[model samples]
Target: MNLKKSYIAAIMVAALLLGGVGAYFGVQLAQSQDSTAQQGGNGGTFADLSEEEQQELIGSSQGNEKLAKVNKAFNLIKDSYLEDVEDSKLIEGAIQGMMDSLEDPYSVYMDQETVEEFNHSIESSFEGIGAEVSMVEGKVTVIAPIKDSPAEEAGLKPNDQILKVDGESVEGLDLYDAVSKIRGEQGSKVTLEINRPGVSDPLNIELTRDDIPLETVYSDTKEVNGKTAGIIEITSFSEGTAKRFDEELAKLEDKGIDGLVIDVRGNPGGLFTAVEDILKNFIPKDTPYVQIEDRNGEKSRYFSEIDEKKGYPINVLIDEGSASASEILAGAMKEAGDAELVGTTSFGKGTVQQAIPMGDGSTIKMTLFKWLTPEGNWIHEKGIDPTIEVKQPDYFYTNPLQVEEPLQLNQNNDQVKNAQIMLNGLGYEPGNKDGLYDQKTANAVKSFQSDNNLDSDGKIDEQTANKLQADIVEKIREGNNDKQKEKALEVLFQ
Candidate 1:
């Protein structure tokens, strides 16, 4: 019985050993199948890839490789983060990073809430404080307040540095952020602390918000060299500006005006089409006026249609404050040789933006096109150079006009004297060469204009000097109405 028990035990041990070996081989086969399936699904294993593929796996691809690195870092944070993170905030940050990459002062990413507020401002007439704003020298400056607005009523002037809005510092805020903060519901009271040049201390003013009544066109008649010149000051290119300009032009013509001085000073542009229509009134033929280049390397040309009133001599005046549509118009007129541009270099603003509507009530204002001059010059970074440059006087041109006779009028600091010298050469008696543009100089200018038969506004400019030289029949003066047609013809040809 003992021997039989021992043999049975040995057989049982062999069966157990065989079973253990089979189980081990089965596990090895299963693992092999799993690894092969993983390789097939992912296309290849990490060990099978080349050096380039290895770098790509870690996101080292060229052409936006920086963005790829950022994306990889974010993914790592998401996958291996110790604490849970909000995906929405991360997404928002990514959007902001995208905008920051563009490095544009005007281009920005608006959060959903801010975008909603912006939409409300455009669609409805809700307002907090009314002021046109811009970023000048990296500071938030008030361009101009709307006429009859709370800002104007509160004695807010143009070029006022808005230091604070409702006690919030405007230091770090961009143009759009500052604008958004200043704009709010109508009837809401807001306070502004400003820092002006002439003011001794910071000026604090409190105002209540109201509707911003649109005043697109401002016109007046200034008598120059005994002839009435229509002076139209346009602050913006709104929907009503073109129609208003047309009406103003008709009124000036009816009043027997000799020349037109369109002042587009301190004008920030609005709509592109409105300025195009305005340009058509002066340009006679269907000519290319401006070129638009997009992000995708696509381009488009905007043309000026022919006008019936091609007889008018239009002189456009621009300054450092003129931007966007203002620059576009100036460039177009100068290229067409239809008008003379006189003033300082214009503000460089070449990009065209479009407010793309979201499914929600909000919108995203994205710069889509870059504006180009007719001469194919990009006005971005580099501003428009004036054909004729004229600098303003340090002091006002008052009726009595007392010149601040500097102790010594050196050539280095006597621009007025230089102007007088130029005028004297142009056959205008500028009294004594005292290096001053005073009342005597103004009177002398009037006398010169009277003798030359031009407008008697006492303002010596390129147009007036050119007219005086062209007539050559100096001292044989004629009425403005009689000389208007001739001057217009001269300007048209020039």
Candidate 2:
């Protein structure tokens, strides 16, 4: 369905959980309490009722034995607990317990503070390291770091499994609790022990939290296969991301680039509306973008309606970090024959969550629906595999770079080409790997150096060259290691 209708549904269902609880126990307790309070003053107890009256009360209360037992436990906790507990806390705890019983990770109860933080994270800036994270394979994994954010600045990469925060193991922590542990006051330092694939030992990295401004769409131009191509990287789908994407596409069209590379590498997805709006730019008018099946087995289809397509050959770059709205966009484009997907499989997250705000400033992010591609494919646990599977370099996990001779900018040799391949594989865009180092190549080298805690002088000295080559060799040793961008360019040029 459309976003407007979905929002209305969310508002209508905001009090569903509490209302259900109130229907079951709240009314009965209130009626019994009011009778006792009026008869025997405010300090009245259920003991005032005779045994027969208590049985009658239970009988009248829906004849549900479970409700009676729950009320018994509530009163017991209130009377015999060592510490006085607020009724609100007890009620919220009940709600949390109920949600936890569902055993669904996406279904959660947000406290007032958490609700506010969640809203702020989507709509505005927040104090954090700025990484999109989720529970992957039962571990808290970094989906992708936001570009230029503290997470990226600290060299955090996608698929990095967070093992500990401040030396505390997060083995049994939920996603929300893990995120809370990582986020703190701005300028505060947080240390993360990460277990990345292909690495034996965990690596500890410290990052300073910052007020991260949320920006989803970024664009630039890159030369591929002797042709200039537009590269639009969408970090995540946020509010107004569609508008931003349209503006960027317009700028790229004005440049008249040969091809377009839409990079949703580490994007963990966001608003459904944002994805719906952005998909219209590339897909044909009225083409089905995504379909959602609700609770009652009712299905709704979202379609694209842009009359004119960009028409440029499009290549979508994805990795394990790409999920949710990223999948929606990529799946739509691929199914519509509008783009060819490059890179590795996307992080599968086919369910849709509706954030319903409660009256008490708390919220419930419930997974209300499951989404499918235009071709009716369910990629929930099973990810969307790339038509061209290009694995990232193994050195990203191996921690060593290999090179023999020092390579500088403007050098034309196979060594420079190898360095370029290694750099691209490591997520550094060092122009084309034609064996000739250009200015973009130097800048990419500097960026890599800065990220790896080395000198950022834009020159590949002996030390830098060795590091780059070591990474390449490690990838080669891992077998079938080549540049993903190279395959992408080949597809676009073909």
Candidate 3:
């Protein structure tokens, strides 16, 4: 029994002895009161003893049979152990055991070295081979490569299972150990062997680590439906994101863009103020953008503050990769009828994480709050489903970072054909919607790029594919078919 319970039991026993001959009835009554008091802390009192007597009563349980096993274990460790050990280490081990018992992948106790590394990563940016890795399905999978980082330059992609690090087998290593292997001094090289989906052989990549600059907003423009559509991929709501997004907006305006596509895929999310500032550029002042609800049903509303709406009918692209602050952006746009969400449902991580610093410099990140849309819908486990569902094109470009389990190639791979078909339907006229890519298709692709202010290389990269796969064209088509584009605009502005 624990010390608290032992002390309480001792008091009860003492009270029973003090009452003497007629104490049986009183003892039963006191026991009932004690049980009720323990259940809910009802300010219970034991009036039968003085302060000194109470202390003595509690001390009587030190030699009780209930504590015999604990005492014996302590004696054996102190007297018969082969080596002398500190009591503090044993206590720390016990604490570690308690955390292990929870069986939660996210929650873990960090030792000194781990604690220091985690703290440094959060504060000062470090040099490393930049890839977000997670222990998923009993293997370390690449969530995504940081843009322009060593991993991205080496062509790492999401969902690539890492089989080896620096030629060392990673079969039994934990997530932390794998991360440690990947991180090192700048200019140092690390090699990763990846096992990816739909690839023939295990892909090997050697990357030189570098200090990665974490930017929040990335933008590019492309042509669709004979019109220039400016695409901005927002990775996080960092302090610089609003200014970066505004810069992109100005560039798009200068280029006379006709449409906008916002990519929020694989965006882990960040600061609320940054999100609000961003919403201001797209939404009208006084429009509800997001809401936070507490367990007590008290809600706070966050509204857009822009006086004028500047956003062209926007299309927000999402997938199982987008999360947190990204959801806030997508949820707000969808609720306000400002943007049409395309692609798969998001990552469904709606809860807010707060880092509480311990007396030591280490901090514990705990999920303290949850986020909601302006409509007051909780987005915890249930993510926001897109108005238009589109899958990420799997066959357009092979993942060079890792080779997946061999596919039964006899099955039809239709992603390229799907892209061609979708591109044709949008009107920027790529040649014939044939499954095979030819010279005519390449010419049309170049024309589209030159007109849209893109790199004009005619090569369909992942970013280009992301834009093509979005639902902007489909949403526009649906509006045209219903003959409601004009009417809907009137209602929306009104």
- How would you encode candidate 1's per-residue C-alpha lDDT over 1-494 as one tens digit per residue? 00000000000010001001000000011121221111112223332355366457634443565678777877887899998778767866776667656655544555667655544454324355655565666577765444445665465555688899899999977566777677666788888888776544576667787775456676667665566767677766654668988998788888988778777755655556567678767654445566666565544555554554455567777766566778888888888746777766876777755433333333333455577877778987567887767644311110111123321222222434544544564456767565666766677667777876767877656555444433322211222322322333234324
Of models 2 and 3, which has the larger TM-score? 2
TM-score of 1: 0.57
Question: What's the distance in Å from true for residue 114, model 2?
Answer: 1.4
Task: Tell me the deviation in Å of residue 194 in model 3.
Answer: 4.6
| Top candidate (lDDT) | 2
Deviation (Å) of 307 in candidate 3: 5.4
Backbone N/Cα/C clashes per model:
10, 6, 3
After superposing candidate 2, which stretches have Cα over 4 Å from the reference? 1-66, 121-123, 136-138, 223-228, 307-309, 399-482
lDDT, candidate 3, 1-494, per-residue tens: 00000000000011111110000000111232221111222222322244466456546867899878756876788788999978756644544554455543333344556556644564435578766565555577765555546675566666688999889988866556677787778899898888877665677877898875555576776655466777777765554667888898889889988777777765555555556667767766556676654444555555554676665677787766565567888898898746778767876655543333333443333333445787878886567888777653322233331213321112223444445555564555656554455555555556655766666666555545545544333333232432212222222222
TM-score for each candidate, following the candidate numbering: 0.57, 0.69, 0.58
Off by over 4 Å in 3: 1-105, 108-112, 118-125, 135-139, 167-175, 193-206, 221-228, 250-258, 284-287, 293-299, 381-383, 391-397, 401-494
Q: Output candidate 1 Cα RMSD.
A: 26.5
Model 2, 1-494: lDDT tens per residue?
00010000001122111101000000011221221122213323232355467456645865677678777878899999999998888878887887777776666777887655554554456678877776665688876666556776566777788999999999987667788898887899999999877555676777898877656677878777788788787766655678999999899889888998888776777666667677767777556777765565555565555676676788988887687778888898798846889998988878765445555677665666677888889898777889889875544433322244457777886556656777987779988877798999999999999987889988777678656755554444343443665577678868
Checking candidate 2 for backbone clashes, the offending pairs are 401-467, 401-470, 401-471, 402-469, 402-470, 402-471
